[model samples]
Target: MSPMGIRLSPLGIGVFCLLGLGVLYHVYSGFLTWRFSFLLGSRTGDTVDLRELLAVSVKAAELGGVEVKAVRESNKLNENSKGKTREGADEKLTRGDLLSNKKMANLITSSFPGVQVNTEEHLSEEDKEAVYWNRGIPNEIKEIVKNPKFVSSESITIWIDPLDATHEYTENLVNYVTTMVCVAVNGKPIIGVIHKPFTGYTAWAMVDGGSNAKTRASYNDKTPTIIVSRSHSGAVKDVTRRSFGNQTKILSAGGSGYKVLSLLDVTGNDQETADVYIHDTYIKKWDICAGNAILSALGGHMTNLKGEDIIYTGSDGNEGGLLASIGMDHDALVEKLSSKITSK
Candidate 1:
């Protein structure tokens, strides 16, 4: 039959429609996969989860993978060569020491199988004893050990947990995997990272540091945006209104990683980029580490209310507060608002 004379059967038409639908579904699925893969791979997308990332990191480390390293014990050469030894370096306690000594290793091993726990040897018996008997360290002291880079600055205390929300992982196996990390100089966080594991969401920033601008610009349209915690809307509003004036527009966010990731959204297509200040009322060390890494790498500021730099591995692990900025006026902004924030 001539091409024009050939009449397609109803069965053929139905088959063709199914084929088209299948093709379309496949294409759509492929697109989503690509998008998710890209975001996860770059570690820059909003949907990325900090906890999951850390869990994966921990899992990889367990398998002898190199995605994550313990900051305290990993750099022994530098610690030894720098001649910077802690007070009881030889007699300091380690995470392993605490775990083994307190018989907590079995608990951690049972919860997170194959994951290695390495505690800093510099921690005094008191600190180790606390962590051993308490199951978790005080938030204040945990902040100090998380970020060791600021230990010498005398002004900075950086707290970082490549993985946060361990309880959630252990309890429900929920995707609420969070990485709690922050940098508090003078008892405040100038840089922070809060990453969610399941959703692939991340919040990161450098406050009062000149680095957040570039980092924000990379994810946003170069517009200054401040990220505030949804849970701390009142505190954020108070601080913003008092410091940036009531006219200052603030973006509300959830989780430390998500807040920082919002700043990285450069498109600015959404109303999320109306302003340029990212704020978190309260933050711990593990929630801000990776975020700090991103901000510092990008040239931003991360500090605490006292206008000090966040340090780590000190005898005392407490950091005062957290403050971050994405632009050049970070120091000026911190100085201006330092007096306004109520002491915690």
Candidate 2:
């Protein structure tokens, strides 16, 4: 007789506790993925800034168990015409509805005042409050604010892209859109987090951290795969074609942030995911910073076409092209490309 209930064997009690722990873990993981996925999903729209984040969705999509409305055309313009009218889209009063890059920048600075943040926009006080009230903040970020000891680095730098792949987003390629945040220490990336709003896929990693399902990438095929921009291809295509020739296969994608993660896609299993990522076009720092961090955390490599490191300075522009790979011989690849293309 244990209290008012029948007594159980010691082994039975241990088994029950383990089962309880497992259930608790499952619930926590689901809730985390759902919250972040929904946060990213809610702010996705055709235009810039100003959005009201409710359980509402203009597109018919399910994220983390919540039903979202399908994204519909605003009807102000037709598909036949390429037009954009910003005559009266003022949203000062409804600023809280949007998840602008400024808002995210403000929140990160607030969370870690000691750490430096480099973002695309200049953040004001109002933007900080907007993000806080709108639930755009993350749990791990909040925890880091409370416990600095959780991260080993004495000093850290943050790079944020509130929205990546705007071209695809405007072109109705919803699945390619992503929200990225990367953390670096001593000018080296240590943490990478990527969230796909429409797909409800959130993957994160840390350098030297324990491995997860997406940690490993393998190439067992005879033909190597390379991912480049879907929309912008000319110099990269011609240069790479002449460099690698028909020996390697090339694929086009939308976002630079997402392209780096494709190296770790794991869908083709560990054996068939992409092997190399190259871009000859101009790439802003915010575009690939997070993806590069995530790739580095997973033991991948990224450098300029000259085979030099592209330093991460969040606000400024970068020189030369990029070469990123998962466990591939980067220097050898660059040596082959250098013969065909000149490093800028």
Candidate 3:
């Protein structure tokens, strides 16, 4: 009434102040509950939920695998040579690679809008569509881990190998082929999924979070079995001979993903098993990142030949060469072969 506004009496003003205080208290209580939830691993303020990411990655890998298998069954490779590898092996690409890459990229992009994705296939502008899949978390991974929240560094990077072992796939070595996906945070791989399209086998793991890869029954460390690339042997056989002696039982195979899965006792269409997987040439991160995460989850180690850890910073390649082992003493093995097997 004094300044063209209705005036409130003293009692009315007091009542208004009491109501404001009640609202403030309610808001403060809600904040406290949210803080408590964050501390208990239920809510992540800035951190991404690795469980959700893992589920999405599994779907992406499987979808990619479907495309790869369908193309192989249809017998339309449309293969083109992507030049030759340094080791003189024919580097090949096919229509299956592109289609698989597109499906995986679309699903991941739809689930995670702004996340950085690096894939092995070269895609056209028309292949970059975002397609969301309406599905819940996979039952196999629903209660796999106690705390599924990834509270570590928030900088996320996804690596995809749509059709690993493309040359082998073209040669009808379906056992060596795999579709792979890996999630690395702060240049460290924490989640991995490898799917074999031909055999319908999938192995996944999250660091500090469990893995479904079973241990091999015949893992002999005394005279360890080593697997090397058949296409790019390049002195690895000699290195194994020097390190583990002449009867070390060295097996040659294709596909980095297949070699890694062999360590996990995932014998594919054919029976293949190994205690160690070694590569002595430049290899891409997509080819090895999923294996790294899976091995890491199972208390194994995957590092460079010089006994150094490989940092996944979304680069094109790693020239340190590969040394991965399970159950065996990794440090001792590294010391033995680091001097022998080198990228030349």
Candidate 4:
């Protein structure tokens, strides 16, 4: 009995100490992991900050080499779209024509210096090539684009590379246009941001349990307003007029993010009803994510024409067609429109 006390060999002591150290390390790591998960995990029924959302959109835009100045100009121009025509008088350009138009190409090239143009005749081709050339729009994006489950839920998370044509930035300035990043929850758009680097304009919205999701910055009661895409087809106007009649005033806007933002009343009356609707005849996840987040945060809904909730962050990321509306009547409106639109 060496000292009649608990005696251990050096090896045993070393092993004991090692085990203790390992336990300590694990405990520390577990704590850190939990902290991180808590921060990143989506919380329901919480108000999201709009300023922070805008910051993220701005960062995403900068990554694509879009000039902040151009984004700002685009935002300003969007703001001026009161009582303007949603569709241009000229015949609609085919996918090939829009992608290869010399003027459009020149604008894109001048705005972004290092981008290359790979024209295609079809929308699918343009989308595929964009994903290949722009790493930001990853395979995940393509998967989501093809999948339908993601856009069918009430609460959804959406990710986007607003300007996926960073390389085309040098070749086409307009290619550097801002894109939308959005997250919708409970069939409502809660978080949204628009990053337009070329114009130095970034806008974001977060819904905070309000009956009216429109932002205080751009609300007006004098106008029975509607928002539609400027670059896309005027089919939305046709559908809207058919549903709401000619009494509703429609406004054309560029980019999904801008159109969504316009509904917030950035320069108008807060009490005015700013109903933002989207036909999204050619919708993309990246195009609507940020705007979705903003609207959801404000307690508005963004769904497909079928009245099904849109989801994001799934294996397949497809939303059949987008239909957004502000206030309690969103579901009713969808129901009413679904009966008429074959695309939904």
TM-score of each: 0.42, 0.63, 0.85, 0.49
lDDT of each residue in 142-248, candidate 3, tens digit only: 87865667544348889999999898899888989999999998889999999999988999999989888876766787888899998888888988899899878
Candidate number of the best lDDT: 3
> In order, what lDDT does every prediction score?
0.42, 0.56, 0.86, 0.47
Clashes of each: 95, 11, 0, 80
Q: What root-mean-square deviation over C-alphas does model 2 reach?
A: 15.4
Cα error of candidate 2 at position 86, Å: 24
Evaluated at residue 179, the lDDT of candidate 3 is 98
Which ranges in model 1 have alpha carbons more than 4 Å from their true place?
Answer: 1-177, 180-196, 199-214, 218-224, 232-234, 266-282, 315-318
Residue 284 C-alpha lDDT in model 1 = 46
Q: Rank order by TM-score, top first?
A: 3, 2, 4, 1
For candidate 4, the 10 contiguous residues with the lowest summed lDDT are 129-138
lDDT of 4 by residue, 1-344 (tens): 47886789999999999999999999999999766434432223343323232333334444433432343334432222113222332222222222322222232223222222222112243333211111122333233233212122223343543343222232344423454445444434455556544454555544542212335543333334677655564467787777777777887654565556556654432122346566646465655665666666676667777877666544323446677755446767776667666552
> What is the C-alpha lDDT profile of model 2 across 1-344, one tens digit per residue?
67869888999999999999999999999999878545443322221111111111101111211211122123121223223212222111111112335545655444344456766545656656422233342454333333222433234566766556655655556566666666666667666666666656666655555223254436532356888877655478778778777666887887776687678764532122467788875566667766676677667788888888777654455667788887777778888888788544
Relative to the unseen true structure, what is the C-alpha lDDT of residue 315 in candidate 3, on a scale of 0 to 100?
73
